[model samples]
Target: MNKKPNILLIYTGGTIGMIRDFKTGALKAFDFKNLLEKIPELQLLDCNIDTVSFNEPIDSSNMKPEYWVQMAEIIEDNYTLFDGFVILHGSDTMSYSASALSFMLENLAKPVIFTGSQLPIGDLRTDAKENLITSIQIASKQENHKPLIKEVCLYFEYKLYRGNRTTKINAEHFQAFASLNYPDLAESGVHLKINKEYLFRSSLNKNLIVRKNLDSNIAIIKIFPGISPQVFQSIFNIKNLKAVIIETYGAGNCTTEAWFINLITQTIKKGIHIINITQCSGGSVIMGHYETSRELIKAGVISGKDITTEAAIAKTMYLLGQNISGKSFKTIYETSLRGEIT
Candidate 1:
């Protein structure tokens, strides 16, 4: 007989956890102790659901690296007891949190699906139940007694996106997140479908290692027309700054002006890694394709390709935490480490 998969639902606070008080019509935290009753559909799945909630619920806007480390600790502590994990988080920072977790959980051999809803769980029109239900189903999916997805992923609005590849696109829509550069790993419809070709392949021999230390001394500078020298210098002058993400114009194009080019050169010389990422939503950074961007390539700016700003920040923090410096830093950042970039 096949043993039912044991899935752990980590509720870190969000709209998904909110339930309504029938008397007052106001929302309150859904009691996870009665989660099975709140969403009875879960009983139909061939899995055992256990839950763990944060001691104090936090708005996603206030989420920080400490919270991320706390999450990693929870997963690491329960690694051997659960076959898969589902996290209920706020949509505002879901992509960032998910992206951070993807890098933090190294060589994962089981699914970690992050999900949330746009409306309170108690609302009749809420999307929470479906999201919560499907996330567990995806987490529990296995083949030949082995897990199907072995990476951190965000499942929102019926699509399973690589956590690092996703970006929140809309604030009010049901489909708030999108993976513009990379394809969806799976999609839910009349039938939940898995795109096997897009899933992250893992080595069964490797153990999952969680990295808790994250360096936060970084900044993202968006290049704009008429950007003054004072403004540019102010960012570069940030004390102990290790890296910066330069949000260049389309195709990584930036002003070829001497002041701007010189700043890039000076920043690189100071050992601050400058990554040139396009401000455009769906295109890769082709640094040397244009005359304007050629100087950036010459100035030793690392092309961010199609990686989202959220992932860039998270990846930079993770790499910086590991003290990965010198020449190889650019090589590692440019390479597609967690399928975040093309």
Candidate 2:
């Protein structure tokens, strides 16, 4: 028989890690050392689990590349000793964190499942236990003795989505996340069904690589009606700005006026990368689909295709930090590096 898989639970602070003091109705972080005591159901799983948490956990809003680097290093240090990893992060910025990690971890051959709850684990009606439980179950999934789910993924509300493709769409519902362009990788039902065809199978022959450097000198420009040239120019001219994700209207369109194109063209000449992403959650950016967007393409605006704004920003930072510049930078940025774009 095959040995039980060793799963690592990296708790980076989120609602899922808290427990309530029922008497006072207060909540606090649970002791991971007594994980079984907190969640006895874990002992029933068909794998062994070990957990590591951040020394001083912060809300996901405070999550940055430095924390991302620390996460990568933790996984790298324990790569061989574990079979899969489940990250507990705040859902508020989970997509960005997941997308960042997807880029930082290259040729990942094991699952890096990120999950969190909309409500505290200690709350009687909390969604934490199910999300946490199912995530661990998915992390332990295997086939013919080889582990399944060899990529960054987000699990919540009975669905597993590609990490970089996910976006937290709802604040109150249990189904808080969505992967608009990509199909669900797995779903939790009576059987925990996995769409085998959709799982990303990397070449195990390639050793895992962690990218540490990330550039934060980026901004996002969301185009709106009657946006003044002064306002647009201010954002575009931010000091040392390396990249910008322009959230255009439907189908990657924007103002067709000559002045807009001139500003875009000038920015491109100055070595600033501008990515065109649709504001709509469900459609790909077909730059030349409309007269409005065609000028952007001509002005050297890179297409984000079907990627989300969160993924776009994270990817822009990642590519910029790599020192990839000019046409080569655009080419690489336009390509789907982490299955982020469909």
Local distance difference test, each candidate: 0.91, 0.90
Worst 10 residues of 2 by lDDT: 196-205
lDDT of 2 by residue, 73-192 (tens): 999999999999999999999999999999999999899999999888878798998999999999999877767989999999999999999999999999999998999999998998
Global local distance difference test of model 2: 0.90
Off by over 4 Å in 1: none
The TM-score between candidate 1 and the true structure equals 0.98
Deviation in Å, model 1, residue 195 alpha carbon: 0.6
Leading candidate by lDDT = 1
The C-alpha RMSD in Å for every predicted model, in order, reads: 1.0, 1.0
- TM-score for all models, in order of appearance: 0.98, 0.98
Worst 10 residues of 1 by lDDT: 333-342
In TM-score terms, candidate 2 sits at: 0.98
